[model samples]
Target: MAGIVACVLLSLVTMVHSQVQTAFLEYMQSRMGSVEERIAQWHDHSSRYSSELRDFKNQVLKMLENIEKEREAMRNEVESTNVRVDRLEREVDYLETQNPAPPCVEIDEKLTELQIKKKKNEKYEKLTDCSDTVSQVNAMKILKRFGSSAGLWTKDPIGNSERIYVFDGAANDTFFVFPRMKEFTLSTSTRKAARIKLPFPWIGTGHIVYGGYLYYVRQTEEFQVIKFNLANKTVDDSAVLPIEDQVPVYGLSKHNYIDIVADEEGLWVIYATRENEKNICLAKLDSKNLGIEQMWDTPCPIENAESAFVVCGTLYVVYNTKLPSRSRIQCIFDVSGTISSENVPVVYFPKRYGSHSSMKYNPKDRQIYAWDDGYQIIYKLSMKPKDELH
Candidate 1:
């Protein structure tokens, strides 16, 4: 009986120990699953933070590149400014050397006298009737016979008191120089002559002699004012007058002619356009570079203006007349906006209207020269007050 009871007690102890082992195993499995879940969440958060950091780094790189490019652009701009300033300084020094300071004089009195002269010149009025007597008028006889189809006669631009220049456009494009004297008679010789060849073949309309150079229009695609240097006998392409954009349909036809005149104020280019509502443009040329300095536009008084000339800063437009009673109509305009519609008497020329007729005023002689190209004769009219008789 004692042996049997000991065996029963051993069995009971073995069963209780197996139950305790099973409960311990179940608790350990639940704790391990919770820890594994927390670890997985941490790993996901780390990956997201890494991606955000990479995007921020890329943005910083782009910003740095932009800043670098801007710095380079600023450096280039500063360098260009410095170069321009240096060039300007050099130009200023050269101009100073060319024009020296004049001697001191009566400043106030000289200024007052200049003001008075300016006012007097500004108050220009149409003078009395121009003389109609051809015989009584002083004539400048053409000494040299040029084969010119078109010509302009004007006073010497070099300040020679007794000389005149004749720019013959079609006569082999020659420039004839004539000398004035006490007696006037026709001759067959010239004091000096020069041949001017333009880039184009067409002859220009109006011509002006200025500072040993002859300025005329080059009837090219764009009506360009060409400067022919007599000293070098070369055409200065750099000194072309800027008028292409200033005029409408610049080189449309021969009728759109450009008239050039030079006076105390410098060179002037005058033209009337039919396209721009028949407006007239007057441009003051830069004497040194032949650039347009100042421009003025006004309504044209006459249509199909044949010729334009300026005297004492006053502009005159001449129109052709076919009627026997009327020879030519002269329209005077003051560009300073002072005078308008001043009726100046027209001088009658009997059967002298030609296609290539031109008129010029000689300030030194105070005479008006009208060229009759058809007859190859130049008729002179005196502008002097004494010569005007009713």
Candidate 2:
């Protein structure tokens, strides 16, 4: 009975071991198949990515080739333009060599014929901006040094009166009147000059005696043009200037508040009146009533400018350094359109005592009376048609 029981137990153990081995083999086979499927999917994805990369590379190569072609075309165009420019330059050089420039005398004659000047009396007329331009400052004669470094001295622009009036400073009540130019030039003392007193003290260096009347800026106003009789020493008329901003007329000057000048067209004034405070403002005044007849916003700026003078309705702003170097006419604004900055040549004043305090242009003598650092000066000018200027 014991042998039979042992045999049954062994058979049961063998059956259990066989079943476990078959289950392990089935699990291994399932796992291997799933892994193989995953590997196949990965391979397919890599192949698609590779194909897309190749397509992108080809597109990039095509774009680069097109860029190179455009670059070559641009290079060719630039080369063609350079060649044409070279040819034009050569042609210009050849033409210049063939026809040399004419003499200055002949050129002046031709320019005089071509240029149309504005008549002093003509109020309105169409004309070119090339009538007459200042070429050279021929002679600079320093008359004498009087009073302070800043003053004004000038003869009456109109009449044949050789009398010269001298204002000794930017602010003053009295001025000296000389009998004649010769007497003033020879005398070193102020005793010889007749002292004339103004009813009101004047301010700034923009004062001038014209037509027996002294035009100046009065001390009691922000900026007023005062017409005083030189003979009677009384105020004839007064007008407020239309200054947009409150500043000096010349930026470099300390007392050139507003400039009252006289040209061929009569009384005028120069000031800065723009909102931007840029260019100078010119106004024409009626000598009788001292009313504004016309106004022109000129293009001449007040920068580094010490003074200005008008000739035949043309405004010439004179520029100089505060340290006192050479003075030059940097801007020209003509109301009649007969003179422009481009039309005029670079006009430089000869070096003298110092910067000019006041410069007055006389149409009668065709000269400039200037006061430079207390020294009275006469600048002889060379005028010519614009075409004759270089």
Candidate 3:
């Protein structure tokens, strides 16, 4: 019975050990399966994360490539702009070197001859005759008269009676002032006169006395206007007359005559071309620098404009008509630079004496003085009223 009990106990112990072993093995198997599933999920998650990282890197590379392309385009644009600026600078430099100073004189071809002629002939009549004449001795007395005439006269408008100014260029090449009225007498040989010497030997073509100074034009290689101070008796300044391109070069021929006159405004240089193209050019000067301020070219050429003088801004040109007897005609030109078709009647002077005559306008007396050096006489005439003349 004791041996049977020992065997039964050992079997029971064996059975318990087998059961515990089975339970432990089943628990270990379940744990292992869970660990295997976790490992597979981790691998799938890592693959997805790597694919996402690669796509992010590709996007970054594309953005970098776009930025580089934009930078290159901007650089190219800047280089093109720099090249254009350099080219523009070079062009401006070339233009400045090619032409330094341009001409100040401007041309206006719109002005017509008919317009000028109409202005000139507005006052066709009312030009008075040369009714009065004065000898050189009684030259001052002629200024007191009322009638319109042309003559030589001297009156001390400045109240300086100690000396008298004379426009006579015949007795002396230079302008002269006499101390006494008797000195101006052509017949008197004993009377003395003071002469204002010029810088060069000049043939006085035209002259005017203004602001106590004498202004005249001398013909040299070209016409030059010389200003002589009457009080100081010194040549103040001089300038060459600006001739137009159409005008012929200087010569000793008949085409070289230039007439210069001045009114209250300033000086005027009048000249005409020779031959068929008798183009007339008038230039207004700047008194300070003697530069050309304004210029006008006549619409049509004048036939024979021997001498010219300005009065009340009207230009009167003396024309010698050899035909129908030797007589002189006064052609009027308005300020518009138009010649009159209707010839104004003037106190006729012989064509021989016309060359020696100097026409001048006295603003104070409002009369025109024609100094006839050939006859040694002066003719005086009054300017007609604008209403009557026009």
Candidate that scores best on TM-score: 2
TM-score list, all predictions: 0.51, 0.64, 0.49
**Residue 35 CA displacement from its true place in model 1, Å:** 99
> In model 3, which regions exceed 4 Å deviation?
1-173, 180-182, 244-256, 264-266, 274-279, 299-302, 322-327, 336-356
For 1-390, candidate 2 gives per-residue lDDT tens digits of: 899999999899999999998999999999999999999999999999999999999999999999999999999999999999999999999998999877775357555433322222235432333366567788888777778988888778777788988899999989999898878888879868999887778888888778999988885546777889887777878877544455677887868768888866677877764463766777777778876656676677777888999876678899988788999998988676655788676788988877888999887787899988878889998887654644
Q: For residues 1-390, what per-residue lDDT tens digits would candidate 3 score against the true structure?
A: 999999999999999999999999999999999999999999999999999999999999999999999999999999999999999999999998998878797655555434443333233222332212211112212222211121223333233454545544422345457775455554243237675666665554355566666666665666677777777878888887545333421111143355556644456666654432555556565555666555555433355444455554555555553232333434455553222425344535434333424555554444444544333334344444333332
Residues 86-146, candidate 1, lDDT per residue (tens digit)?
A: 9999999999899987888766877855653343323323342232222223454443335
Residue 225, candidate 2: Cα error in Å is 1.6
Better of 1 and 3 by TM-score: 1
Best-first order by TM-score: 2, 1, 3
Root-mean-square deviation of candidate 2 = 26.5
> Which runs in model 1 stand beyond 4 Å of their true positions?
1-149, 161-164, 169-172, 178-185, 189-202, 236-256, 302-304, 322-326, 342-356, 374-390
Tell me the whole-model lDDT of each prediction, alpha carbons only. Answer: 0.56, 0.79, 0.52
